[model samples]
Target: MPSPTHDALRTPAWTPPAGNTKPPLSSRMMRAAWRGLPARRYDVGWEPGLVVPAPDGSPLITDHYFPRAAGDFPTLLVRSPYGRGVPWSPMYGLLFAEQGFHVILQSCRGTGGSGGRFGLWRNEAADGRATVSWLREQPWFDGTLGTIGASYLGYVQWALAMDPPPELKAMVVQVGLHDPHAFFHANGALNLENALVSGVGMAYQHQGLAPMVKATLRLQRRLREITTARPLRGAQASVVGDVPWLDDAMTHADADDPHWLGTSMGQAAERLDVPTGLITGWHDALLDQTLEQYGRLRRAGCDTALLVGPWTHTSAFQRGWPEVFAESLAWLRAHLCDDPSGLRPTRVRVHTGGDESWRDLDDWPSSPAVTSWFPAPDGQLLQQAPTDAEPLASFRYDPADPTPSVGGPLLSRGAGPRDNGALEAREDVLTFTGPPLTEPVDVLGPVSARLSVSTDTGYADVFARLCDVDAQGRSTNVCDGLVRLRTTGQAPTRVTVPMSSTAHRFAAGHRIRWQISGGAHPRYARNPGTGASPVDATEFLPVRITVHADSELTLPRGAAGTVKDRGQPRS
Candidate 1:
């Protein structure tokens, strides 16, 4: 493979045609829908299909959007594999251009007519550098550059940070991913549903809306059959049409596996000096990755800001776009344009669940108090630890009848908080509930479950979830985690399951609940008790999992008092 810039060709920037400079009707409608988006300061002009040479001399197709006004503006680069049309053209290209930015929206390798095969994360760094080099030679390039996008687009930004150009000044990573390994195999378990959803999107989304929709429908129609395949490895290829990248991701479960080396851009966060604005939702699939990068950036003393909403991966771009757009625009203006007036005073802003309100804090986890609730044999969550050693609460997990996944932090549309009443009614699920809270309790940090567990079959998975039980007894999942276990037969092992992080409140009259299950099927691949790879397992076995009375759920409690209201977020 030739280096991305090994024989880079200088390409002339396409001049925008002198035509109507008014915002398109679609752009106007989108702007209207996002109530708090920055006012459009200039009409936009677009120059499409500008060719930039990738490092290996492949043509990376790009589109340029600039203000129709007569003034220089900082450029914002948004490279995506998910096509350069529809939402991308309007949301990032037009919107940012109208806000006085010269937006360069490009298609990644092997997508949207760009030359070369898409090698997932492999081609981003060099392609990004080559694009920047091309930008430097453009007449409209003002030398100041910023990158912005969500999901895979965010991954490209991190890849660019690996060898950041001097012109790169700021970045906005929304629900982005930095580690492919963690995204696919979190806690040694395959994130099956997300993997499939992502695979479908990557394979077909850039092709066009119709193909993407058709592929999505096909996957949905065959989802059950695909997920339940005895040997899971080849099932995905049948649905997505031979996606080698997805296959490779599913095969490598170990982070240290040679296949995943250099795939993580976490080091970029730790060393990046550019001003970065991070955005995510409590229910977003990449929530943990966003928080992880925030911590790393903060520790490195990098200028960073974080915004977390009450949204899932897709909803963040829809319902949460107003706040998301405002935050991004403010951060960009502050850093790139040297205009900090719109920036918030605090570094962190998060929306608290239950209350459905936003709060600004000096730092994440603004509270230091931790509360532990022990699970008793009587299915109660008690503040005090148990003294008596009682028989363990037990449930059987059958791979043939895996516990179905409910709404949570998933990439699919079926993600976010959902009523778990039906799921908890299953025999394989265990729930421990605490008394109704007289005063609302705010939990604003990491949530975890510590378990003393044993399994008859030696191999199993422990899925722990935290929920808020409302007055009507509807249980809504807040955060959850799963750990694949390999233990000695019947010997209890103590393990701590990090159930992600959340900013939620247990409202008055609401009860706190801790749910324990063997596994959340399809969300995570079912564990076969024969010590076989889930992808290649030919045999399914039932395992009896037991939880001891000593197990506890730990929650970070915010300070007692009303969290200062940050006012209603626009839209």
Candidate 2:
């Protein structure tokens, strides 16, 4: 009988209009921003080193830049743990200031020149309210306040959004995390790489270390060695120096633990009523979290807009997309300054890969056509469910020889989507490849998989990745997930894992591939398979992992051809 893998390329390719990318800022905008603006109505004024008292009476440092020609202008507040004197201060301070708004760049407690112990988001809620109260006391206050920033800075906005101040008007949060557990421990496994890198980085910043020293410590090789060390609980102290939070985080694996609960937005997500704008990248580590925030705000009846692009966290920061930037500026103007020029027609805007185009949607999974794809014994993916009832493919997983971390949604090093050729070649990795697609398959929403697996070990972790295999045979990861199994009886266990969401088009002639492995070490700490704590486990237990033939991958498919904004699915 002819194999299912041979029946490839049966559908036609779907092509869409390419997105518009603006060139660098014009000389007019740059020159005017540097020197006093002549054509604009307001000139920028910079005021540095102002102190605001937190609720606990700790002094928080702030710098203000307001339009010289301002008359009761609204203000934009950015609370960041990173120093305020950096370029971010002047960039937004001058831009928004010249745009006729007051910009206050304040360092969170324990960062920059601020005089308080920084404990991540612990002090943010109380400190944020206290700062807003201080803003209201100012003679220049106009009762309209907005928040803006990305990453950690973005996180502060969400902290306040849970219980916003009376004077708050709008917010623009980019790539922020709503849940600490999702950010730190994804799917019951410690995101060892990010946790270690970020912990050491914050420690270095807190100690005011030299930039070169910080860079050397952030080196990938050094990070890999540290992450691969035995017992992750206290191994990072040598590099990071007594981070209680990191230690506590490693020990508390459960998301419901009170330690993790203190950092979560929880019911605050539903209480938020501010007009909000969200920005994220397809490869951003917090992409899923960002998307969840948008959905929650929308459901809570808040005016919200979402922008997603084909970039990584670092890329989005260093070389931001002009379209997204322009949209953000417009969002701020509309919500804070009451200017409606930047209003977007569609609430959700996603940049689809493959064709390199932008797609507007009403909501996520815009009319999804979910398709269930099954695996064959010979490493082929079929559209229909398999009939076999036995284990067709099996691999031996050794904690000592755990699969190395590769490109995906990681932080510091090896972050974002990358080719999986080398990773897929490992004996421990089992792949189910589909034949070249005849037509483009637009996958634009949540992706998940259900695996019928049996393992000899007491505990194991399953890592799954969805990839697009081009005609050249390069397998680039689209989305992936991890699920840790602590205990499973001898019988085959059925486990479901949800992968990251994305809007990508697998073009005609490209193949859809799925890779399964016991672990993506360092990205997630490897399970020792001994039912012992991974932190101190010293044994190298090799377990036989059997993936039953009936395992299935569920993909949320969008309209097949020429997708447009709010249009009917193509027949």
Candidate 3:
């Protein structure tokens, strides 16, 4: 783990031979794929495998990409644990470098031939400060800096923002995570699927392409067996190898637990004054976190912009990359290079579902109106509250046959919108359908459900989902939320579930549907009726849940009179 000598660090592993070279084929292909990108202004040159010392003197492997043309430019630092090859090099290093900025792509400690053990978020702050110290000594250093990245890369940026370097001028966090506890255990339930997927990626992706592919295949093959194991605690090791971090993450479900101290970087956003841009998808697994930071940054009187697309966590890098890249490039140029020509006029931009079109606004919601819909006894959703005194709907939820998850927000390829007809047909799921809409309903901002429920067992969970039912009766989920329940007696207890936010349209002739269930298995660890943590539970029990007529669903109405009061439910 010895740091390389200063003389050796100055030597590049590989560099361009002559002047005015053409951009790499990979860069050209990516530019073509990401159509409408700014024209490449300069050819890119890279010095790979340069050694930078971490705070503890561990050698952190790094790559430096710069424009071959002769002009000084601001530096963009991108730290990642996913290695510095394939997508990282072409997507962040060469592509940005060709646009006339110096790009530093460094593999986080212990991930890609770097010294020191990777302990999740433990070393990012110290390592990032050390990297900045190294940057200051370079002969080419120009004293200006910007940070940009997504996911854990975004976390690293926040780590640095804890004590932001003076040279740092701007930041762009895409589908970023500011709170690890919120990411893993939001709503008092473990996000089992996302956790497992993350564990696999962290443990294998840095190894190389072949090893990563093999591990992904194995995960896909054994996911069911692993998720449904009796004692779910150690079952994940079979698929993701020995991941001590994953075990620790799963074991500590409480956000207030001592194990989570110093893990959250949310305070950085609350007090930050750096001009920042945030991007995420309506269906991204980390959507809530991105939105949370955006609000905090705004409250702090910091300059910030927000963009939300109709995509999942992974798609934001693939099919959604064009928008993601354009947003990032514009923010970096405007803030770091003092070029605002590429910037859009609006502070908030979002992609609305159903129509699948983008909208630009001064800010989110645009002062929307709130509407309430009440569930009736006969599987009906009525705008007016029911007059019946004791109307009730009930269903039995058996952990052995837990309700299956069908799309919505997730990290796997199965993320985003999907047909939920099969899922709605289950006996354990209760659906209340509204009459067909005579006009399109434009919904924006937060969605929530206030439910009055009673369960046979004191320990349970309530999952609420909003869906759009087409003419063919196919239900597609829009947004959903789950909250764990603990009650003392048979009397119904009222609890409000935050279904997150959305910008969507329900077309004319389509009906709105409210789905209520005990749980969405795998997406959330199944709640055992015995009140034991799902990871350690060996016994499963069935619980009967009852929803009262007083339950209501609330949505933010983007347009006035968009929803017509059609008389009765069709289903």
How badly does each model clash, as a count of residue pairs?
3, 5, 0
Q: Who wins the TM-score comparison?
A: 1
Residue 448 displacement in candidate 2 (angstroms): 0.5
lDDT of 3 at 178: 85
Tell me each candidate's RMSD, in Å, in order.
3.9, 12.4, 5.5
Per-residue accuracy of model 2 over 1-571 as CA lDDT, tens digit each: 1112222321222121133221123422543445322244565666677899998888999888777652567789988876764345545666667677788888888888788788876988888899987876666666678888877778788888878877787888887776777788888788887787667655555334376266445555466566667765687776677778778877788888888767887456676888889998888888988988887887898888988877676566545534555667789889877798768678888878777777878776587579888889689998978777588798998888889878877666567778889999999999999989999898888889999898887578989999999999999999999998754766788899888888888999999998999999878888888877788777768888888887999999775333444322110
- Model 1 clashing residue pairs (backbone): 4-55, 4-56, 5-55
Candidate 2 has an lDDT of 0.76
Q: How high is the lDDT of residue 491 in model 1?
A: 69
lDDT to native, each model: 0.89, 0.76, 0.86
Q: Which run of 10 residues does model 3 get worst, by summed lDDT?
A: 562-571
Off by over 4 Å in 1: 1-17, 20-36, 388-390, 560-571
Deviation in Å, model 2, residue 222 alpha carbon: 1.8
Candidate 2, clashing residue pairs? 9-438, 10-438, 11-438, 11-439, 12-439
- Model 3 ranges off by over 4 Å: 1-34, 388-391, 559-571
Write down the TM-score of every candidate.
0.95, 0.89, 0.93
